[model samples]
Target: MSAYAIARLRPFAEPGEDVFTYIERFQSTLDPFGGRFLVHGGQLDEVEGSWPGYAVVIVFPDRATAHAWYQSDAYQELVPLRTRTIEGEVIIVDGVAEDYDPAGMAVRMRAASAGAV
Candidate 1:
């Protein structure tokens, strides 16, 4: 199954030219690991609860690949630059299978919970 790394970022202040440089470098780091940006920009609309700033979604072949890309030395080096400019949260989640169904998921969840009891 595929996986995604999603980021919700709120910039503390306007990004300077160095921020652009960091972005360019960060993008280049993704290609080798089969990671690509799905969404990278400011919010277009807010239908429900507030979204303070931008959102980004990066797709990877699978969860392991997503973790590898995130923990790689090259990407880690740029972490400070990103943290300094923006306050954000990032998470990785596995994608559902092509044949997934809501009912099936509910059943699975119930089974798992029962097992935990």
Candidate 2:
């Protein structure tokens, strides 16, 4: 099944200044893992949270791939940079259906939810 790494980060310190150096360094190390940055530091026009902050999401081929990247030496070294700069939550989730069709699943789920035949 395909998987994703999702993170919600809040600047415990300064968003722009505190994290710039380390993130640039970390980005270079991600090359080996096939890590693609889905979202990085960007302006948030809207936030529905107790804490206003930055959100990031990375997509990997599978759960193992995602875990491997995290446990890799490159990421291990760079993780401290994120830890020191941001207060955040990280999660990895398996995308359902292995090859999911969101529109089709939504139709099925809605039918099931509403008891439609």
Candidate 3:
């Protein structure tokens, strides 16, 4: 399954050298893992509750690849520079298959809940 490394970052101050450096070097970290940016903190039009900051989404070949990229030495080396200027949340999630059905998942969940009772 395809997986994503998503982040919601809010800046503490005006973007500085560290922020620029992180952006410049980000692609190299993803190169070895076959990761690509689907959304790189671009402009967003909000219609819901709230999204107070920039949203970043990087898609990888699979969950394991996503995890590998996150834990790799190259990315870890840039963590400090990224964290120094921005603050927010990051998560990894697998994308659903093309033919996935929510009803089937719900049925399985209900059965599991019933079994637990």
Best by TM-score: 3
Q: What TM-score does each of the candidates earn?
A: 0.88, 0.70, 0.91
Ranking by lDDT: 3, 1, 2
Stretches off by above 4 angstroms in model 3 are none
Candidate 3 to native Cα RMSD, angstroms: 1.4
Colliding pairs, model 3: none
- What's the distance in Å from true for residue 56, model 3? 0.6
Candidate 2: list runs displaced more than 4 Å.
Answer: 15-18, 45-51, 97-117
Q: Per-residue lDDT of 2-97 in model 2, one digit per residue for the tens?
A: 678888887665646536767777766667767788887687767464647777888777899989888888878877767876788989887676
The number of clashing residue pairs in each candidate reads 0, 0, 0
Quantify all predictions' global Cα lDDT against the true fold. 0.89, 0.77, 0.93
lDDT of 2: 0.77
lDDT-best of 1 and 2: 1
What's the lDDT for residue 24 in model 3? Answer: 94
- Weakest 10 consecutive residues of candidate 3 by summed lDDT: 10-19
Candidate 1: tens digits of C-alpha lDDT, residues 1-117: 999999988856779766777798988779888999899985559899988888999999999999999999989988888887788999999999999899988999999999999
